[model samples]
Target: MLSSRHLIFMEVARLLSFTKASQTLFISQSAISKHIKSLEYFYKTGLFERHGNHISLTKTGQALYDKLLEASQLQESLHQEIQQLNETFRPPTKLAIGASTTISLYVLPSVLSAYLRQYPNLQINVLNRNSNNIQNALLAHEIDVGIVEGLTQVNTLTYTPFMTDDVLAVCSGKSPLRGRALVVADLPTIPVALRENGSGTLAVIDDELDKRGIPVASLPVLIRLGGTEALKNFVLADTCLAFLPKRAILKELAAGELVEVPIQDLTLQRTFYFIQRKGTESNQLVNTFIQFTKRHYSNRE
Candidate 1:
């Protein structure tokens, strides 16, 4: 178990705000300050440098935080193991997972249902957010795991490949591009319905287009939808063309509501990753679920 001072230090380091830490811990600001002061005095070094409203970690603080993170993980792992042994039936564990919109709708439900059947005592909470928000949730220790696509450069997070999905260029059957093989340059002439700015799908599409020297701004975008389902509905009703995850609109395509047109110069393959903070040890339930996901997806791949 971590000391109260150490826990406070960790929270402060993670959030970089005394007020935010206080709100998260349900403690007063002065109490947070006192805990930090005690921790700094014990270590005989300063942990944070405050400038106006902003605070940054010092070098010594960074080193201490890394060590404390390892220690906390070990302690939690030992506690969980002991709890598991003590409960003959099964120890209850809570696992909070964050996921982007497309994955939450199309992918995670089946996996989570299978996991729950095996580990009946485990309580799983899934938070659906955009890719960037999911990353932020993982950093804040608000979720045990995260699944996202694109923008994978997180030093503190460990990513393992879970699945690969392709983004398809699709339009209503009535659209002019419905049966035509379109090129990347042809995107600018089509009336496009795009996903919102922070969406992983949109980010990947923008990045791929940028690589081909085509700017996203040049596209004739009709409307920006918040989720894949919304975008699919927009395309189904309107003449707007959309770049959507292939898996997300499989039913629509099969039913002939939408037509998938291959893009010549665009390779819009996106990989989903299972993400967790580096140096943290997962509880037994989390470990089991992760193993189950790997086995299930591996066989499919």
Candidate 2:
């Protein structure tokens, strides 16, 4: 890892404000000033020209900043590659991944099990969040790859389609709506269970319904929950209906515990995406995992 001071300097250069960098780095302004002074002393040149509260990088400082950014990326990449090599002799190749709730809960676990059967030395750490959170994690460089169901494209991240998932309106077996295809306008009459605001599933549901002139807010939401399992459990035990990914309710649907209520003249669907930082298209680990996921899904079809 680069020294804290160097990382701090990089933030300062990127943001062009020591105060802003200090807040981002979670350090006091005095500490940021001390680090900058130390760097300036070592280089025997002023890195920033200060006037009032604002600061700008000097000519020499600009060159140093550019070179620092290049060197840091190279160093990090080399470290990652070297670690991958080192881990081959040692067991359990470490991989960090992030995914939206539906993929993490329903889709990826089987793929992971199959992958581990093929490569027993692999070890993975998974972070589960909403699609928007997963995208933010990718941009923050906190995870190597993300699987998301984001309705909108983020320019800073690259998205590749991994699979298509349909969102189904589901209810418990005893509900009057069971097996009865519903008109779009009937959605507002039923008591509904919903995923929370940041949910990718919720976003798609709202967007599709909005296009049909029935806003999600117009629905009679009986409860709001964070995870699919919780919402599913509620639907299983109550008459309230939920819109969930079809993949998520396969077991329940098969067991006849839940019913897929088809909507009249409308379909709800979204793509599950493999996401990475925009410039990481060629990273070995990311490529390996994405290819594995795609091939795994294709084999099922």
Candidate 3:
């Protein structure tokens, strides 16, 4: 078993902030410092380097933290195996997951429900933000795992493909573009509604459009909305067109409330990824949740 001092050191290293680690571990900042000091004394090396207000892990600290993480994983696995052998009641565990707007709203609700049913003692918290914010939260250790639209190319993060999603051009059925085949040239002529900046949907759409030699900035956007449902409602109430994930509009598309306006040779496909900090692959709870989520979607197919 890892010592309490080691656990405290890991938390502080992960967050790189004594105050944050203290709040997380429910201990006073002074107490956190004392434990870290004790660990450093035992190892006969400085574990953290301080620059006035900021703190960062030293080389020895990083190495120790990595080893402790491996040990923690082994401990958790052993505990799980023992529990399985005895069929005993397990203590409640919390898993915090951060996801982009689309996945949070359209994708994860059913999966989370099923997961809770299978593991009733587990508590799950879902943080719904745009892709950029989710990536930031993961780096800051604010969440255990993250699901986002595209790969955030930070070397410290690991991205696992969650699923592929298609963003479709759709407008209200009353719009004149209903049944009209649009070409690349016609995109700039139409009034478009778009997701706000820093949005994963917007970023993907912009990248695809740029590849086609027609930048999204060249299009005549009528309004920028924050949420998917907000933009969908705007499209329904107005005569403008918008790009939305197919999963978000299935009911409306089936009911004829919206019509898909297929542009000639324009397909917007983006892959959603499950992201976590490097070396967290050994986390059993996160691995189990990811597999369960993938299975939930695969079973439907």
Summed backbone clashes in each candidate are: 0, 0, 0
Residue 216 C-alpha lDDT in model 3 = 93
lDDT of 2: 0.84
Candidate models: Cα lDDT each: 0.84, 0.84, 0.89
As for model 2, its CA RMSD to the true structure in angstroms is 6.6
Candidate 2, residues 57-83: lDDT per residue as tens digits?
Answer: 999889888788667656646755886
Q: What is the C-alpha RMSD of each candidate to the true structure, in Å?
A: 5.1, 6.6, 4.8
Candidate 3 C-alpha lDDT tens digits along 1-301 = 6788988888899889999998888999999989988988999999999999999889999899888866866776776667668878485576889999889998899899999999999988798988888999988767889999884478999999989999999999999889999998899999999998878899988998899999999999999998889999999888788999998999999999999999998999889999988987867789999999999988976
Q: Evaluate model 1: give its lDDT.
A: 0.84
Across 1-301, the per-residue lDDT of candidate 1 in tens digits comes to 6788998888889889999999978999999999999988988999999999989999999888889977866765776778777866454466789999877987788888887887788788798998889999988777888889978578888887788889988889888777798788787888899999888899899999999988788999889988888889999998878999998988988999999888896889998888888866355555666789878766655
Candidate 1 segments whose C-alpha is farther than 4 A from its true place: 1-76, 83-89, 281-284, 299-301
**lDDT for residue 141 in candidate 1, whole number 0-100:** 75
Better of 2 and 3 by TM-score: 3
What's model 1's lDDT at 215? 79
